[model samples]
Target: MTATAGAPAPSSTGQGGGPADDAGKESADTGPISAISPADSPVSPVSPASPTAARPLPPALPQTPTPSPEGSRPSRNAPVRLRALDGLRLLAALMVAAYHYGGRGGEISQAWGSSPREQFPTASTYFAYGCLGVQIFFVISGFVICMSGWGRPLRSFFASRVSRLYPAYWAAILIVTAVFALPWVAFKSVSPSDTLVNLTMLQQPIGVDRVLGVCWTLWAELRFYALFALFVVLPGANRQRVILFCAVWTLGAALADAANQPFLELVLMPQYAPYFIGGMGLYLIHRYGHDALAWGIVGLSFLIGQHYAVAELWHAPNPSFFSYRSTLGIVAIVAFGYLAVALIALGKFHWANWRWLTLAGALTYPFYLVHEHLGWVVVEVLHQKLNIPSYGTFALTILLMLFLAWLLYRFVEQRLTPVIKRSLTAVRVR
Candidate 1:
């Protein structure tokens, strides 16, 4: 364990999906998601997981201190804004977008086979390896959860998550639905039930078809939030309780993996939880210095779960485990990736802390939400009928995606999120 330096200074964690996991509610020190002038906007690097000697809480926020692991309200660490996390958010989104662009629009069933170099003679060369972005996102998801809940009340935490999550999500749904409705792009005809269910981001267990494939990750994200919120509200929560919870989670994932039960795997969110756990481990090490428990869980997660994660995440084509792929390679790749997230949390990624990038990071949630299906449809027409080169198609699709993502962030999301936060703040005041 290294020294716990530079935890969230006191203001941010954000809307759950991207760097902005709690982007709504008290996402701003003065106002929710206050206007993002480069000179004033926050990079929102990380939020503390427990109370300690924290920076000052925002003046506008009335300090209604709640009991925490450290003792009373006064001792609880106020949230700090970490600047580097926005860079990670954009990076993760780009990876996922690359994966989709290069890999026949990746799904749970996407298989790059044993040799990507040989098989990916075309655009696959570019997009095939990028699917690991989802893994990176899981790690971010775990960190954000702990950061967001650090010392907030249960009602406030839930409200923060809701305000952070729902506005952009609803906007994404409408954007995608409208894209299909316009009729210029070739697309699947989604049923009313499917569209409605997909909007909820809870379609899988219910057996409704997702409006887009990437929506599956959102479901797991919401579930993880639910699980963490429970941890937040349970009697006498603290770091040790969290550690025990993760240990039990790791054990359950191992059992589910050995059993090879697909439905069960998802229900437990086990296939993806280790990466999420790895993230939590990073936060712990950063918060309290390296402890045996945190490091052990992170290492064990990589050792026990890497192979299983690659198999399920990549969905190896031949079906005999890593089959054509190198098992060690998958393990190494995942281990390093998880470690990278933790390192970034420690403010080691200062190079990525440019203020302009926060705008890019803010766009990640919307970018991820709308890109896949629309890009697929557009790329299909551009390649098939218009006969655009792979490179050109990818470039144009990215531009379109960027434009749409920006519109959502600028017009729809930025506007709605603050309103939600203000309403919630009023509730707290009352």
Candidate 2:
């Protein structure tokens, strides 16, 4: 999801209960809270059961509504916020940072006729694993956006999203530009026009890396948001209907990849679409109040796909076949996407919470934006000036980056968010 444009404002609490309470009541009012049985739900792609079906079906159990603590709200501190997600983001960021720094050492070592891996194993592994973080971020974005927008009006949903993401993002680009252009630093390659394009979030449209280099993910995310908005705008956009949309998108993406069609790749990449749908699906299950068993199934599906399944498929020798890659990857992506949704659905369940990690997760966007550049500078300076070992330097650089991220979150992002919100509000009124 996009970094919210405003300060970390708490979601508005509903009277006598919060959004959770309202959601719970709404779920009850809607109907039975059992898992959306493949046979019963129109959203499920399975064919209708025959009257002469071999075995008798078991009676559906009444879903026990998970009890939420009083006065709970979904925010940075929400108990349902998965700590694993934070850990995942941390892992991804470090991977990217290591990849960049490690590659630099690799370049130097090649010139010196030494094995780069021996000198910079940390960097090598990080480089290898860095792109995984981007995948994880895509999944997380899909899940969070889906959960946050579930049952909310499309207009308010879009507004809140724009409000939350743009402010900190714009501020970050400006800060980065200023730093890069400093007289002492003199890190100039980007022009003012380029900076403006990056700020407008259109860097990807013209086929150039944004000012930050890593901002390509933002383009993907924007596309997901636009698609999601379109899905909601279509007639009969309900939980079941959206699930079908996700299934179609997931399968279609796999098909496109198999056909080696570039235009289709833009739409069919599960990373581009399924994760968001999975997130939406999870939110529907949660919003409808499915039992723990259902949540378990979703989680299991996500883990199996993310860890064991996708790795095996992607690591295949000469595995350039689009169908193979797309099929496995899309399943994993959609699975994890749904798992994130499942977690959100059971937002009343408090098991996933970890305060510090949640805070780190909240800082992910800024950390992502700043870590590479700042961490690169730190690693270089330490290596060149102080002659630090690669691993030691890597560790130290990450710590320093994290510290700087904390300061940015506390001082700049935290402060400017509210001001941006107010300005947006005033503009809307006008």
Candidate 3:
């Protein structure tokens, strides 16, 4: 019965009806974004090359990542994998799922015949804060995008994103819509036209209702991709330019917030930009060495990010349900997110270097896409009609979601990514 905090609903309120609504700098130097291919940056983590070597900026990246003299720079050919990031990505997805399932409010009582807070008294306290996991995801995206896009061309970056996001997303929308269409199901169904719009991932901006509540996050991510492709990848990234991009975005977001400029706020995303920017700064440190400028960007981003996080807590739906929320708690959680990524940037989480972590990470996107709406149905059925215990229903729902996520990734994503990437790569500008 909990509402998804900060997730905009397609309709006024309630679960069945509709879906809810929902960085970095661097210098100039380097080849265009596509210069590096999969071959140039290998995925094998067992290589002798250090993690720093896996994503070196193009040669002649002055101030940020200039080429070292012979034998100085890490070998790019070996491409070290940051398996830890995959683990973190999965963790973020789980956090968001937990929040959506148990944290928002007592409306869940309608389904379970008991308030979530009562059924999950101890866990709901922490899960209440899980909505912030979206911010953590944005941060991770910033880091991963910057790392991957470095030295790659716009087409390649575009292809990778198209391949990675759309396949699982398309699958989720169709599957969820089909579930809603079931006559016996309690949730509301979308019209064919709305379902079509959801496929485009432009539902939020174009005023079309979304098929899923989580689609809002995809819209934000698409914007971030466009911004990065235009400003960083197209122009050719270097340390100096990347740094400047982060700084300017930070300033623009601040001004937009101060002036109450809707247009600027829409483009700048004042509330979420800090996490992305911070993530990019962390990537800079990961690829290059730690520097004052990179650390400064990260520091500033955390400060700005925490401020908005607190604001979001205050503005979140159902104020009465979240009366226990505090500014300190929000700030601490956001800070912890930054710290986790910073440790990754500094290569301090090597313990997460398991091969299975890659599969866990791959499951994240599909898991996230399918979890929310369908999950409620599963929770309701298992707990109510089936007469399962509350705890058993919760655990089963999570496991079922995870299994479905894996199936989507294995059957749909793996099959479609290459086709999509190839199709996108074939398109050329005049």
Candidate 4:
């Protein structure tokens, strides 16, 4: 495996588990790494692992994406290469970790309210804003999925998506459940019904919550996959059609929000669709050159995305979590926009090719999967009993979480994804 491709076993976030040797300023493979084909091998269009072979760009992304002249846009039998978005992935994951760490201070404070409480005041105050990372993740997901899905069959896409999501997710859920299920530190009890529900990663739609709270986002991610899969079937689709389809989606969301239609909002993914849409806009620019349609999508996404922040202002118990000094109405806008700009830089700048950043990004999905509740439990237990300052506990917690994420990446997601892919890819979608 190249040191920075393949990730997440299939959920939350995944760090790259493929080779890092080829993460150049101009990425040449359609993938960071693939199980069916190695990066250096002669391009094989028939390989099940060719994630960017000739098919159709999803209709959801209507306008034909601009491609770099030499290496973008594979022909019917051509090879496709994609720049690793590992750096972006890692940045987004860390943001969520920071958000959890910053916000969960209240949990510790509640547990030991009477004691000496001299802890990270600034860390507590500002890091809470890291919650914007989840939105960043959604945008990254949209971009990555589009990159991965180009010129591929729907079944192949499903196999690729499923293989990447499930293994690491299952491992994480089992580990965390075991941790929380212990009697001495029992924060939650897991039952068979919950276990079964979580295994499908559809617990939210079924009215059952996930064993790990973060698994909730998987529902939205899966929904996006379903919608975008339609576009993959329409290889002949044009930009105007894709733009119209997305515009209609946004309108549906706006109408849902205006009428407070909870079911529509929940099913349509209204809260974060614009970010996902915005990410697709970046994908077009990143793969192809700038076009009016792609830029228009980004612009309209920014405008329509406002509905989320505006709605949260009225509904969220903590509105500051959604704001950042008002330079942008929502912190997600700044995060998504920053990342979009960064995508362009990756195309144009050599310095963006740092190897370690890609490593961090590859491990992101696994880290995000494992960090949340377990980290909170550790901080609460360590600081409350041992009298460690919250800062010390927070630092230690981050270290521990990062270490665990590395383990998941190195041992589980990175190692196992290929085996699963080889087997799944061999099935031939009969």
Which scores greater on lDDT, model 1 or model 2? 1
Tens-digit lDDT string for candidate 1 (43-144): 232333322222344333223333336431222243434445555556666666766555432221122222323334564544544555666666665655
Model 2, 283: alpha-carbon shift in Å?
A: 3.7
Global lDDT of model 3: 0.64
List where candidate 4 sits over 4 angstroms from the true fold. Answer: 1-84, 104-118, 233-244, 259-263, 313-349, 428-430
Across 1-430, the per-residue lDDT of candidate 3 in tens digits comes to: 1243123442211111111111111110000011111211113222222534444332212113334332233223344556666666667667777776777553355566677787787888887777767767777767766766676688877776666667777888899888878888866677798889889878778776677777666666677777889999898766777888999999998999899987887888887678778978987777666678989999999998888777656444454654356688878877887898788766677555676765666666777777878887898889889999877988898899999978987798678877877797786779
Kindly provide the TM-score of model 2 when superposed on the true structure, using C-alpha atoms. Answer: 0.64
TM-score for each of the candidates: 0.75, 0.64, 0.84, 0.74
Model 3 misses residue 60 by how many Å?
Answer: 21
Sliding window of 10 residues with minimal summed lDDT for model 4: 1-10
Q: lDDT for each of the candidates?
A: 0.54, 0.43, 0.64, 0.51
The numbered model that scores best in lDDT is 3
lDDT of 2 at 404: 69
lDDT of 2 by residue, 110-211 (tens): 222344356564545434333334444444454445444444455544444454455445766887777667665423436777778777867756654356
